[model samples]
Target: MVFQNISTNTKLYVRKGNINIEVKKKATGDRIRRSLGLEDTLSNQALALSIQNLIEKDLSINAFDASLDKYIDKCIKVTETPDDLINLTSLWHKYIEFKRKYWSPTTYANSGLVFAKRFSKLKNQDLRFPQKIQQELFENFSLDAVKRSCIQIKAAINWGLQERIISNVKWTIPNKAFEQLLKRQKEENDINPFSNQERDRIIEAFKTDCFAREKGRHSQYYFAIHFWFLTGCRTGELLGLQWQDIKAGYLTFCRVRSQTNVGEVTKNSLKQQHSRKFPINQQLSNLLVSIPKSKDYVFVNKVGKPISFSSLITCWKRVLSCLQIEYKRPYQCRHTFITDCLKTGKLSPSEVAKLVGTSPAMIYKHYLGAPENIDVPEL
Candidate 1:
């Protein structure tokens, strides 16, 4: 049953299936006071009009309905109440908290928290406003910063849309702007792998140098460098490897150790979830056999703990300095190995990808060059 009181300025009270709901009238002075619990000394009309303006600004509602429960549900669905307005900062925090369950500590700290903090300064801004977002991007951020911020902002907004905390809206970086960023990145990025001669020189230095041959720290550095060049495994994967992962002729890359802001953390799976077995060559086998298996990890530090990527990099830099080789990051070892494998012509592109735990498409796009020997048909 539904009925309205003329004295109460069209306020409707409905009762259906034992549910009673009171639908507010046209936000009158007394109604505003009841809703707000304001002091009696204030001008009721002025306060009511002020509240009406806020309601008009924040909410979109149809005319008052006879069904009070339906009206209340509709109000809950839309931004009809002050509490219903989505706070961008709050939503971002919620998104980050939700993502922590799935994302690694490094990812959560670097991407999720970084974006949340960046956007939190604009606390109450409506993320649905594209112009405001664009203004924020330009005013306070550089081009590179804008690109990174956009990635996180877009992800958070997509999550909000999926969770129904945000209204569906077109939020995207324009194609032209993104293209410019890509151009900038391409200009900045340089992928240079060591040549065969350079690889040989580096290896020889690691093997023969008196400092590298010394008992404790030097031995660990030498072994790590040789293993990296021979196996083409990522530094994290190599550090994460356990003695049990090594079998008769192959080593399984099933886990990774990454350095997060907190410290080093071990993940049970590799990047891309592509665990693969790499065959051990003579050099690698000899190195493994010489080292004592005192710890679960194949590679460890002075205290018998897993060595970090940063520490490995320090050792690599020292070796490079001693040999006077042109500076290259340790990751170049992976690239060098891939290039050498491709140049040999013994392994196909698919085989290289399988060994490396990546896709054939990646090998073709990034590592493989033109064929050296294409059979010509006799005409």
Candidate 2:
């Protein structure tokens, strides 16, 4: 499916089951709509409706003094702004470009991965961020997108607002949309880690089954799963480990690659940047003893190449298919570990937070579930 509009700068297309959107400032290819997230979901008459609505709304709005091109240019130049669309888009581009320059190869891949599959259904969505009753409308959109795995949609939308593609006033359609999205995305991205039974099944599957056809040996899969399961490390972190990083009875994930893999490997500063340390649990410790690690990476592809996070996911998906288990992701292991710990006994939220490399407050808000009801003896 391909969407082309002579009147609008945005063009959407599908390639190999993935949506690729290319936005031009005009037909001549001066690009403005760098955010292609809406590419997949905007097709056919839906595309016309989306463009018509935005254009109509922009014409109607009191926020911008000018049209789309003038507004976008002003935003890129960072002049005065009365709307969220210009400001938000400006920040979004800055962060994304920065991430590209600073993040690791693996870190960079997750965004693209999520963009492709999460919003694959978004070929044609009515993206007219409702003007009145905006708060209510934004919350509903946020809740729906989160469940569908398009949590970043709101953030990207905010960027559009900041850039002045959308209005930018506080409590305006764009701003309220941003607020609701951030709130809901956090709530929705809860860790439903693999259960004990599922964990056991994966471990078993890795040990016994051989997929990928090319690799006859199951040793690598077994070790990778065990390592990921035990540490609750991000798939890439587990795959990214070097022999040198593993010291006497400890694995230090102090230096994680930035999402882009463009800069030198260092601590992650971005929310997406993950730099956490995991203790040497029994499972990992015992497994480490048996495996003869020769290369820099603890986990490698069958070719003995270091596994990037995306590559690990491809393998993981295959593993899940083989085991016939409901597939989440390797990150779910970390979620499982966190939730599992909370269930066992009372550990200070701060203590658990430190181990997981997040705030204690975050633990309770997202993961602690409901508070316990204490029983009192009748007097």
Candidate 3:
């Protein structure tokens, strides 16, 4: 594969190859080529940063080279300076594009979902500011304004820094802000794993639905939830599971994919490397072997696509209602796994982290919050 100094040419004969962007802007040679080093989020960021760097170099008054200048000018067309720099939406869209280009398909979708929920509010709401984008505007916006949105917002801001859209001069958040938000969120929700009795109740309730769907669809959902509890895998990982991924005592998933409704239907997207193997314990392995490999989805709807989150919601609500048990959340499976692991010492903190695809610090912080009342036996 080869790359040519094609800013001078109207058409680029694109092929399935990589580009190497590390070399200093070379003299307008006959050809220019580079390689894309990796395919994950960090790698994508690297590629975008490299391109952003080249553009910034050209932005400098003294920076000049005919071929590179022409290339940079063309990039400027798609990557435009916003008429309203202070507007967060403009900055977010640019960063979203960058994120889409660099992040894994799953990460891109997850980030977009988070961004849409967290930052889209107050859209087009005017925050009067300098006609020119001020780095200070971002530096000083009340952290409260972006608390829930901060994680992804910071990602976009950091991208802006790389692209030279926002200088790092006064653009920084309080170092402790993110940590606090996370700590608080952990305390409030996402950690209440269901108790053993409650777990059994849900299981029994679902299994009792003999006529559900007049077929096996409801049973499949029940089985999928069981798999989620047993494996401590994310909902997506469970939904995206393919029978082909089973081998020996291991079940594999690349990044698990999920669907979304953003006015249009989204499809299964593996957010993490779904190829990683999980211990297909004797029971899970045997159960998997018995189930017919009828569809590509490990868990599908009646129509045979991946199960919608709403499916679980409806099933869970009815089951909880029938059992007369208080409802927590469908994600309690994850929380339950964490608590169970901690109490039983099935795996050490670090080991649990890898198995669950999160950090030890996160596991401890998000889980292990004591219940309001301690269980004590009478003396």
- State the C-alpha lDDT per candidate: 0.62, 0.53, 0.55
lDDT of 2 at 139: 52
Taking the candidates one at a time, how many backbone clashes does each contain?
0, 39, 18
Q: Provide the TM-score for each candidate, comma-separated.
A: 0.67, 0.53, 0.61
RMSD of 2: 11.2
The C-alpha stretches of model 2 lying farther than 4 A from their native spots are: 1-171, 177-190, 210-219, 258-277, 371-379
Ranking of predictions according to lDDT? 1, 3, 2
**Candidate with best lDDT:** 1
lDDT of 2 by residue, 180-231 (tens): 6566555446566777988988787667656655543454567877776666
Candidate 1 residues 157-179, lDDT tens each? Answer: 78888888777555766646766
lDDT of prediction 1: 0.62
Off by over 4 Å in 1: 1-87, 104-106, 120-145, 168-170, 184-189, 207-218, 370-379
lDDT winner between 1 and 2, please give it.
1
